[model samples]
Target chain A: MCQLLGMNANKPASLHFSLAGFMCRGGRTGEHSDGWGAAYFEGHACHLLVESRPSANSPLARWLHEQPLRSRNIIAHVRKATRGAVALENCHPFVRELWGRQWAFAHNGHLKDFDLPLRGRFTPVGSTDSEHAFCYLLEALFRRFGHTPPPTPALFEALAGLACEISGFGSFNFLLSNGDGLFAHCSTQLHTLQRRYPFARARRIDDGVTIDLGRHNHLDDRMVLAATAPLTEDEDWTALRPGELKYFRGGQDLPDGVPVAAPLLLAV
Target chain B: MCQLLGMNANKPASLHFSLAGFMCRGGRTGEHSDGWGAAYFEGHACHLLVESRPSANSPLARWLHEQPLRSRNIIAHVRKATRGAVALENCHPFVRELWGRQWAFAHNGHLKDFDLPLRGRFTPVGSTDSEHAFCYLLEALFRRFGHTPPPTPALFEALAGLACEISGFGSFNFLLSNGDGLFAHCSTQLHTLQRRYPFARARRIDDGVTIDLGRHNHLDDRMVLAATAPLTEDEDWTALRPGELKYFRGGQDLPDGVPVAAPLLLAV
Candidate 1:
């Protein structure tokens, strides 16, 4: 098992506050201590930092917590290494380039016997079911859309369908982002929180640190956060139902693009 | 023009000492103050850090100089923004995945009116002639070798030929690596230094910092370093001829895979 965290903001924002609490799950509060990774997207480029060490005490992670690397989209993961060796390459949030955009993906749950054929186009650099699944998703998208990117709605639909199909193997809870949007899919467990103009006080669940969210945010700033578990105790975190997919862009949730009434099946 | 630095080692070595001097060129010693990047390969995974700020004064770069991130292969660049805006995406070294390995490339010189048609396989996320040339090289390699990577000799030959073709547009000095090997191409300026058993005192050219290399290294430790200019004051650095390509693996130079007598011409 692993813990995943994602953030989408209307303006370039730092994940330092949330990351401080979330990273506690890597060793202090939780058992996901094998490895950890974080990806911060600045336009089309990303700063991807990963280490095969517990983030709770890693000097690099500590340095990262102090630095305010602002980004519109961010994804992070702390791994427990259920599927692959505890190596640097197996650390999540894995990244790939698709349609001239740098895409990042991170998984929170394990997939059982998830062996899918890759079309030799977006192959995995690491031996992890999560990476294999990410490659499959990219390959499927490339095969369907060719060189040009489809509209956002169409992409959301295709991704929802793919997520549903992949969930059939096992738990496939994941968060994916390509700088423009952040997509989160729930297989068993996932939570979301929204922060806007009327922000209030929040308290960290891992440590008893209190912070006035209003002091750090501007009036126009809007943001959405997704995590496997709630990082703050005071915030109202919404739990997504199983097999649900949510899309967020510019810190606001887009209308439910996937039909929620029926189960999605990727048409081959 | 930008500045390039690369290292290939027989062991997982830290580039902190050399990087300390090399990053000084970002603003302290030279005028490559647009941006800077560094890529360190840990097996198939790469820690790619890029900032659209001068490395000499950047806090992140300062932290990096203090940390000992060990790797067998490393590439770093200080950008001057010859053909692209000073953005994070435009910073080197650029990275892409192919054949289950992460390949990193950094270019030092500018390409004049270099617009080549991409085959829609590997696309450039950033708008730079350097990235465009990198994508062209990858696409050409994929077209020639398909999914499976060719032998080292074949790959060296293919890359040498591609380097020659790309250099026709302008100066294209570059350093490329896929963890297993480091390939350097010289259009007008490139220098290499070999350090092995009999290490001696070395002084930085940018700063007058002197260090006894033998005190920090073991007898079996071997490394090959590539830079646009000699980083140290008292090292015997070899200058590669124009249109010449050099391949290195395990910190040692391989035989001239391409015939030195005749210039390479990539067949369409």
Candidate 2:
């Protein structure tokens, strides 16, 4: 199994603080230490850093954990290599381009014999079940929508339906994003923390580090975090139910222009 | 226009030395300075760093310029936007995946009113004509050869032909690599320097920096570098003729197993 960490903030924010604790899970605290990867989106482009090395001891990972790179949306994964070899290509999160937008995906569970046929358009560069699934999803989405990008509600519906179908194979917990919005689905495990106004002090679950989130804000803007395991202990973390799919944008569960009674409500 | 620098080495080698001189063109020594980007391929995965800010002043670019990350194939570009807005997506060294391999391309020239229709699968995440041309090239290649990757010689023929057609539109000097081989096509301006045994001291053209290449060598392996402009003052830089398309792999002008009399000879 692998670990996933994501951040969606209203303003451009750094992930170094949380990344420090997340890197510990790669080898120091837990055992998802085969390889690690992270993608930082700056508008439409993504800065990808992937290495086939344990994060706890890798100098590159340490530099990233200490770097102050900020992004509106970020996704990271530390792999234990359930399927593919411990190579750089097999690291997550995997990226693909669809509808002129870069989409990224990372999974934490295995899909038993998930042999889905793929079109020549979107194929996997890495020999991993997760990459195969990501390509399949994008292939299906492109096939359904053709050239134009689908409306957000329509896209959410299509993705949720596809997630439900894939969940039948096995555990399919995953986090995905396309710069504008993030989509997370759970089959067995996934947890999230929503940080808004009147932020509270948070304590790390892996290490004994604590930080006060209230002192660094002046706006009502919020940030949402998703991870396969809880990174903090003091804050309230909400775990996604089995077969549940959620879409978040600009740190809001339902961002602007989406109806509250939209079809995405069916996901939860 | 943009400036491109690509390195194809037998062993994993660092680009920091060449990058130091190349980055100077982004803002200091010359004025390609709208934005800059570079992609380093480690195994089948590509580590891409792109930014809208000028490479000379951006902290991230400075860090990358100073880092010791090494790879067999590296492609870097410093862009002066000719067709697109100054944004992250508009930076050069665009990347796409084909035949289960990551392929990166960086252009140094412009195409006048060049817009080709995309087949949805490998659409451009950015609005630059360079990216549009990249998608078009990949779409055409996929259509020509369905699922399997074409051989190096066959791919060289197809790309040279396509490049000849695109060059008719405007200047189209570019560098492309698929982790296995590096291809550079000169529509107007491109130069290459091959470094082998008995290396001599090399002097930087941007800065009066000199380094003894012999001090770092023991084996007889070689590295071939291609760039838009000459990087060193003391070495002989061979300029590729207009309409020439050359290929290199493992630091060789012609890799093993290819008949020297193949159609690629037309490129010479």
Candidate 3:
């Protein structure tokens, strides 16, 4: 499978520092370098870039590190294909339009016997379980909500339910967004961390570089990072409880009617 | 990088049908076909499997369609190399031990200048940015909180701050878990969907097959699906806002102090 990385903040910020080290996983220190891509949200709109090449070698991924594309949310991916051909079309994170908004997604697993019928409203431009699932999700969203977007609470509720049904087919771990906030689900593995004031200098496990976020954002800025694993070497990343779910935004977890277990502490 | 697929629910469910359609994108219909892997969470543990081949052509992906791996949470991925040579050692959803919990992660983007040093507490066996990030994150968490766990609210706050700092380097979108509810982030692109009672039959966009989730889930059961895109033809899928982050557990968004913008309704 591939890897996932995300960030949600209370205010507009740049992921350049974190991304500097994170991108190295594509071809430098790691080996998932099939392709690389990323998105930057500015208000209600998003800017996206993708390359069907390794991040370490891809000039685009390199530029991304240097460019200070500011946004409150961001999604990026590096591929090691298992479901589709190694082409630009199959590279993630995949994007589409729904409820009049551009939605992006990326997957980290495979499902069999999953030849879904595309009803046309949302079609798969690429042939990958990740893309298929993305199109299917959009189709379902259009059919149910049409052009009118649902309230956040209600929409999150419905999405949670749908995620459960689809995950039943196989290991379904995913990251989703629409330039608003991120939604995540895990079947086998997933981890998360939030950063805010009183920030500390942290080191990258992929690279020995360290950064002090405290030097960047105001005390009010808060951010969240959910990944298949932790990204820093001096911060606390929590593991999701099995069969659990929650929602987050503006660097804070939203309150909902779901029951969640207390987080388990991992012994380092 | 690889793709990720995830499902969360209130009850045990199988991803046979949905995963089957998604697998097509791995090689037959999509381009991620370097390799495929998936894991189904059963209680606190997970059932894992992988194949260093196209999911569409891989017998393992096909067998998964017929084999009913039941779980409330699932994680899946299809590789499209960006780093190490195509091999199982480079495959994702990468798992590790933290605080006695198995943590997993999948990445979809690349990092730059990600050369980092480690304390050897957690070493990445694979040469992927995803793994390096994971090991770094775990090491950081252990360094910060040690064997004791912090409160969820505090933990989220710290993680979010760190994520933002790291994201500054490059695109970082990801899904993470420890056999529990999932944590996802969006640096550029990613989307999510939630489903619950009053569910109905839905079609897929890739293979044109349909499944009535209503037949599988109880009226009261809630499920969440997070992906690079939507999965159904008749539902609402929300996009993660740029620079946005979130957490999911149960069937609702967790309440946090951070500000969360409504779903983007920008014209397509």
Q: lDDT winner between 1 and 3, please give it.
A: 1
Which CAPRI category fits model 1?
medium
Residue runs of model 3 more than 4 Å from their true location after superposition: A257-268, B1-268
Q: Which candidate is the best by DockQ?
A: 1
Which candidate comes out best when scored by TM-score? 1
Displacement of the residue B157 alpha carbon in candidate 2, Å: 0.7
Comparison by TM-score, 1 against 2, better one: 1
Residue-wise C-alpha lDDT for candidate 2, range A1-268, written one tens digit per residue: 9999998888887877678889888888989889998988988878778888888787778667666788889999989988999998899999888888888899989999999899777778888889998988988888899989989888988888888888878888888898987788878999988888888888888887898888765458588998998898898899988988888887878632264564454554
Q: Candidate 3, which CAPRI tier?
A: incorrect
Worst 10 residues of 1 chain A by lDDT: A255-264
**Tens digit of per-residue lDDT, candidate 3, span B65-90:** 76545677787888888776676556
Assess the local accuracy of residue B203 in candidate 3 as a C-alpha lDDT between 0 and 100.
89
lDDT of 1 by residue, B55-142 (tens): 9999989888778788899999999987878898899999999999999999988889898789878888899999999999999999
Lowest lDDT block of 10, candidate 2 chain A: A255-264
Candidate 1 segments whose C-alpha is farther than 4 A from its true place:
A257-268, B257-268
- Count of backbone clashes for each model? 0, 0, 263
RMSD of each: 6.6, 4.7, 25.9
TM-scores of the models, in the order given: 0.95, 0.94, 0.48
